[model samples]
Target chain A: MGVASTALPRGQTVPLALRWRRLGRRLGFLCGLAVLLSPALFVFLWMLSLSLKPDVENTAFPPVFIPTSPTLDNFREVFATSPFALYGRNSFVVATAATLLSLLVGVPAGYGIAKAKAHGLAFVVLVSRMTPGLSYLIPWFMLFRALGLHNTLWALIITHLVIGLPITIWVMMGFFEDLHPELEEAALVDGGGIWAAFRDVALPLARPGMVVAAILAFIFSWNNFVFAVVLAGPDTRTLPVAVFNVLTFEQLAWGKLAAAALVVTLPVLLLTVLVQRQIVAGMTTGGMKG
Target chain B: MGMTLTSAARHPGRPARRAVASYRRRDKYIRFALPALLVVAAVIVFPWLYTLYMSVQEWQVGSDRVFVGLDNYANLLRDARFHAAVGRTLVYTVLAVTLPVVLGTVAAVFFHRDFPWRGFFRGIFVLPMMATPVAIALVWTMMFHPQLGVLNYLLSLVGLPPSLWVYAPDTVIPALVLVETWQWTPLVMLIVLGGLAAMPTEPLESAVVDGASPWRVLRDITLPLTLPFIMVAVVLRAIDALKAFDTIFAITQGGPGTASETINIYLYLQAFSFFRIGHASAVVVVFFLLIVALAVGLLLVRQRTKWA
Candidate 1:
């Protein structure tokens, strides 16, 4: 009876105050989160709103946060005016070819370097990545023209290797280092050659790393501007160049511009959202570990 | 034992042959790495060397090539525009890198705490880093409009006067840096967050148990431990900001009276617009050296502060 009487008042008074404090803290956290995220969210939302709204609403004073009557006319106008489909196809081809080639070559190189501990070779490859795109562009432009490869997808594919190959090598190197050598050694002990060991054991193990490398390479190639701007002709221009052309040729049609911008970014955005964990893992490990 | 004894009696040279075979196998890594190295040599190494060759010769469109040894470098040394571009690049890099590292560290610490839907919020935060730069530039160009843009409207709401975002000569670099900060701060945050996640919890808990304040623990423990990661972010950001082109080219094209022209923009104009190939090659070499030097400097600092 004494214990029950003691517990009753304590629970009644203390629990109420404690719950109120917890509720207040929760509210404070939500507010801080909103404030932190608003800027990043605002830029994207504003672009989305501009793309959906008509021209009149887009340029209105006290800018509209939400579109009153969103329409697809702006998107229609963009597709009608530009060869955006062709540009998209060109980008896809270049990015895909570059990524595949980087994997075919860079994966083995990464494995070799990791196994052999060829730090000098790895550093050389990194320097290639760090070198400015423009440094390679002028010479590549002349060489391609001389070889009649300029204004073709071939040129873009070859040039994009500068971006894709290093990333592939670095990421694959990190992955391969993490893998124990015992499995490959066991395969070798069974009279399998080095190539067989790699193919049978390490390659299968490094598949996820290859995926990460391929995605990063493709995204980078897709986003490339300097090489395309210098080398690409009217027929070979990629999506980024197409977007830039929209601004130069068209007047300040905010809706159309926003529409064009969203179109180019959509694929990468989708990839990022879908594989965010992989991408983050790749970025941190690829960047920091090396 | 009987079969092994008979085989050994029949082939005494087998051991010698195996030694030779194993020796050959030791160089197998070279075979695997050859294709990538050859490709890199053809595409990157050779091209850079060719650029070095071109830097010594004056070549322009519709004109005969002339070898002008050291003339281009000499011109670069005295060129006021080149000097200005270099200065602008350094300033922009500093502004961009410092702001992101600082703001990203804060954001990283904030996100380190447990909150509802933290993963969802983090995904939203990283969207900017993934978006295409040209598209981002276009969107920001519209938003930076002096008269009808929402930014000014938001500013007015806070009882502050509207200012030119990317239009004015003096405001253009800072304005561009703002966008760089917005897009890249998340990268720094992610890197630092990884560092935080990997850090041990024992020290922090003991400090808390010892009645140390949260602020003190953060300053004394968290920041010091995360410094290496922060340095990594700084180096990456600096390198990128020094090479930034797509957004600035799209937004201003180095306009407002050449106030925003960085080294990349200037080099582009020199090589393409003016067709001064040799001069532009010289600029490329200088820009490359600057990057290498900055990287080395930052790496040294990182080495000094590196933790296990």
Candidate 2:
């Protein structure tokens, strides 16, 4: 009671019925998020501006927040000079394939662990997830080279699955544990086998879990850089690696790089924003009850 | 086929049932596990074992591996760069974790109740985490461009001269830190927001009734209750920060000097670029041990808390 009431910001001098403080509270909250969010927003605005400005204005002494004359030339240059479209396609395909593969492996793994009540296996999986990607990259580089799969799209997809699968399994394990077992049991009692019970009963209930897993899996795989950097060849290079390649080719092409960055960032950014409410709910549920 | 026939002949119905049941279990195990085991073995388990083997050998590109146990580990122990990398890694982790928690929690508390544009703000702030870090790094690198960079452009507004950002070794780590914080603070914000939303409001209400101030309530009540979630954020961020490479690689490439080089970057260069495979493996082994120790420490703390 003390804590809740205290949080409401009341003063003895001001009457309890005064509504000004509530208005102040709302303004203060908005202000707080503004401060918290400005750094990121500034980045987006700056990049957007950079993408528009001509190369000369890009280096103007007082950096222009608004391009005096915005141009689509940088966008045109990106397409004309680089394999940007191909890279986008590659990233999309690999991310999608990896997400699907992770779901296939992860759902069952999560289910088994949840059913068996194996915290040890869960911990083991988390440890694997925690292991730095680079720690495994070098050896895998050698292994993939030996297998002649290095520099292939297959390698990028598989490597991303390493990132995607564990999170899917971990998050879904927490989710599955929260689900009622009675549904599956009822299906089994109705002459369904374990597979059929899981497919028909548990799977439907697990839709939200699947959505959360798929979203997070896609995001991680799509943004993955280290794996693609090491494994992808010229033909298989993903967007991030492709952008990095451009940076190397023309050092400090600020205008072009910003344009390219924004182009690549827009799709995922929009998707993340659209699903953020569900994502937050998923995260909260997983964290609180896992 | 032979076993089934033999079982049918030996014990009729019961033996056949037993044979089939065991076979089914075996088949399930083999079918479900073999492919997974093979993938994991080939990808994870094998590399780890191979890295251990590599660490004890005098191996380099195009050279036959020769056994030289402990030398690589000894070399890493004596290497000043390794020591510096360890220090940088810790500093990066501490700054990255602490700043986000404090700032994120404060924002979360302020925004705990309903407010206009809350969803929009939350969604936009989380944009950095969703986009590729490398791409963000690329953009920020340009933003930090000595003359053309927005950072300096802003600094000039405060009557300060333009400063080198990515170009200076001293500023490199801090620059990377800023980028990391921008990207990850939203994540912490989400966690803290969730924690705040879930918090019992009754305590705060009673505190207000007793005429206690907002400051007092936050200090005496809210912080203590949200400590566990904050700790979880710290642990997660620490692990991620320890492995920070992509953004740094994209931005400065551990440059101006090795100022921004974490253990991961050090290992990457030694193993891949220079082909000091043994030394790199040794570095990885040490890193692995450190992470294990941290995980164990967290477990012990969790157990102790439960005990209490």
Number of the top DockQ candidate: 1
Off by over 4 Å in 1: A1-13, B1-26, B114-116, B304-308
Residue A86, candidate 2: Cα error in Å is 1.0
> Model 2 over residues A208-246: C-alpha lDDT tens digits?
888998998898898998888878889999998998888
Task: Give the Cα error of residue B209 in candidate 1, in Å.
Answer: 2.4
Best by TM-score: 1
Weakest lDDT window of 10 consecutive positions for candidate 1 chain B: B1-10
Candidate 1 has a TM-score of 0.92
TM-score of chain B of each: 0.89, 0.83
Candidate 2, which CAPRI tier? acceptable
Task: Evaluate model 1 with DockQ and give the value.
Answer: 0.41
